[model samples]
Target: MCNRRRRVDLIEPSVVGTRNVLNACLKAKAKRVVVVSSIGAVIVNPNWPKDQAMDEECWSDRDSCKTTKNYYCLGKTIAESEAFEYAKRGELDIVTVCPSIVIGTMLQPTINSSSLLLLTMLKENFVDSMHVYHDSFTEVDDCEKLSSEKLQDLGWKYRPLEESIVDSVMNYEERGLLLKK
Candidate 1:
């Protein structure tokens, strides 16, 4: 589940959504379920354990995430864990696709908080000018580009990334949100 609220307090919604909402999906006799998770579920301290690599076998350390104030990562970790727990108890056909930092044009009238922050920083002179921590592996990529690769593996196709950006720009323009010249 995506973090849609301004508040960082997510334990309640995370519990309700995963337990009740997931059960609802099963009751509706849904054949398959797909949860869009983040790499946050699998990664922590991006530079730690220099030789370590994460796959489906690995899970993020919730304590580490919490202590470090990686609230977003903590949220993803909990939600995905709940999904797996639910799947384990039932014959639920579920798939969790964890992706790295997702970036793309949004269809919504207003972009998400994270996206808005990035857009503001890139296009306007606001916020911190420098980040204290530098991690080479952490870089943003077009959301459509990344998702398309996974979709292709599953025999699905979507529009090109360029088209996605174009659409985003169009949406912004329509909503009177213009990029910096």
Candidate 2:
């Protein structure tokens, strides 16, 4: 069974939900708001220079995303754009963080999409061998490397990728999601 969330399923939560949060922040007179967008929004554009690394400045083209049926990227782009627009109209300090694929021990009992992706990679023959490029998955084969310079400049630090992967694998094993290999 395909675990992909349909475009319709994502629209309300990604677009409308963001609007709701922004409205609530406005109502509460929040001094600052941090919006957690995805790297999907920044990396999908075909017009960006191939030699340049993708940064916060890059945005996925909404029309291109629509034509490609990449609803997730489209949603994030729209939501982030809306947040910035709202911020421009008001005194709200909106900061958007677009993170790449995150892999680590999950806080919740149920596995999330990113974790599931790692899990699928670990399990041999768990999925069909045929390479399928669906709308839910981004084709990163030709994409430029993503840069976190802006975030690092802000004094943010992250655990090594190997450490994160190990933590996630251990968590999965402890939860009986994966057999000891």
Instruction: Give per-model TM-scores.
Output: 0.65, 0.79
Off by over 4 Å in 1: 1-8, 45-53, 105-110, 125-152, 156-161, 179-181
Best by TM-score: 2
lDDT of 1 by residue, 35-142 (tens): 877777777744445444456666778888877777767777888889888788885777888866344566465577545654554345422223213222234442
Candidate 1, residue 132: CA error in Å?
29
* Candidate 1 worst ten-residue window by lDDT: 128-137
Residues 48-147 of candidate 2 have per-residue lDDT tens digits of 8888888878899888888888888888899899999998997589999887766888888788678878777766533322232222333567757788
| Model 2 RMSD vs true structure | 6.9
Residue 27 Cα positional deviation in candidate 2, in Å, after optimal superposition: 3.0
